[model samples]
Target: MTKDTMSIDTSAELLENDILPMIREVHTDPDVPCASQGDMPKALAEPVAKKSPAQWAYERIIMYIQNFEKQLDNDHEVGMGLAGGNTGVIRIEGLGYYDPDIVTYYGTSEAGAKTQLIQHVSQLNVTLIASPKHIDQPEPKRIGFRLAAGLERSEDVTT
Candidate 1:
């Protein structure tokens, strides 16, 4: 037989016997090498939650403050208020001249000299600057702070 006729006859024979590679509706395990597109298992993907840069900085600042508070000596006391209705004061006690560990100050006029002494103490100086640069933004909503500890030691002073 001629080559063309011989190839056509062979193809016809293969088709009749169902020996050609035909598509099969097979369900295979993902681990198997012969797994088809539909038979392959889905990937175990997880979604990650993202936080804004400002929010991330805020969280980090909070964590750092918390850790610092935890490491502080138990004998110390902390007091907070605004100075002259403008500057914010974070008072750290136990570093003052008062016999008691804590010292309370009101508006600098009330405890002006004592407050100055407290501010100068190397051990009890807790300065927190809430600059707009901390969050890398020119503007921010009303800033707020929390005192997890301190405001203890009602030990001394007047007014």
Candidate 2:
């Protein structure tokens, strides 16, 4: 099958053989494959980022469509959403995200930045998710081994 049609469900394995060796990060060996999307950090998402808040809000609503598709592919009895992967609405004033089942963000501000996001994850029964992106700083936590361990348990995860 062409790479395009190759199933990503087994991406965990493809990651081990095809993608890991060339990586520069010492901790990024085959055992822990990074983002399924690849080095998204190197690829600028600014054009997509420039979209207005309204646009972001709209696009996010359907981010979980594929996950739903997977659930449909199953017999429909058992679904996974209570552990490390789950999606829910995150409301921050004029912002909203129907986040994918694997993203977690926390902020620390007058609005309870660090605490609020931590509380949200705790309530959801999720213990880990992908790291948030920031244009200004390099978050070592998002790099490799750290990411795998940083948010292992959602209850205590915070910036």
Candidate 3:
């Protein structure tokens, strides 16, 4: 099966434009369903607290980035199921040139992953493992990115 890939900018503008609408739908439409609390163990799923839409969006984005980082660090398959039977694998890292070891550790190479750290804004590439049964949909929630190491260090220094 062929994977359809998309490069997305995870900047505030893009998030507001591409992602927020779908998120609004998920939260407001009772039929659409919020993220499944059922899949989680009872201990984890119980005591679900309500949050504002902005907080929910922020939390969801943070969770996606953190999960992606864990998958990269552990060398696990970094895939998430999207709507309509399509699955996607996400890769994100710091901006700028990285040593070969860093690239290798992150399971991406200069040719593949080192294209940009934070060119216009934070960016990510999503490779969708799609089949004929899968229909494409806007899934901004699936994409994530993190600050580049260099950028983080610089900010730390300035602070």
Candidate 4:
């Protein structure tokens, strides 16, 4: 669930490590998957993610940031991927404080409800939802990964 079969190098040359912390819009709710009753736990199956789809997407980005905070090293890399234009890359110099967000596209027209759904890197409250990943072999892609400091957490974790 870490590196891909073919490594894609993303050198950290975007910004200086002397970047300051930005108080981005705080996020709380998590992007919980509506798993089938059999596939999910008692708590997950419940109605937890009451936030609007936009909020859910934002929390997902925050979760990704918190999880990746642990696995990546000081010399780590970053890149850009598209989730229907719902994502933007935010690299903070030397610190791996990546944070992806979800921009809302109110109307679903020919433009195709465009919104940002990024996989950002940052800290988060453990009270949020736990990792929403499948334990199956070859873990799913880290669409919403988090990188909290220390090993008592998941690499692509949320809470």
* Most TM-score-accurate candidate: 4
Least lDDT summed over 10 consecutive residues: which range in candidate 3? 97-106
* TM-score between candidate 1 and the true structure: 0.23
Which lDDT tens digits does candidate 2 get at residues 66-122?
222222312221112233433332222111223322233333333333323332322
TM match of model 4 to true structure: 0.26
Provide the global lDDT of candidate 3 against the true structure.
0.30
Q: Which segments of model 2 are wrong by more than 4 Å?
A: 1-49, 74-159
User: What's the distance in Å from true for residue 34, model 3?
Assistant: 8.7
lDDT, model 4: 0.30
TM-score per candidate, chains pooled: 0.23, 0.20, 0.22, 0.26
TM-score of 2: 0.20
CA shift of 119, model 4, Å: 12
User: lDDT of each structure?
Assistant: 0.30, 0.30, 0.30, 0.30
Worst 10 residues of 1 by lDDT: 39-48
Error of 1 at 112 (Å): 13
Off by over 4 Å in 3: 1-61, 68-73, 77-91, 95-113, 117-159
RMSD of each: 29.1, 19.1, 18.1, 20.5
Candidates 1 and 3, the one with greater TM-score: 1
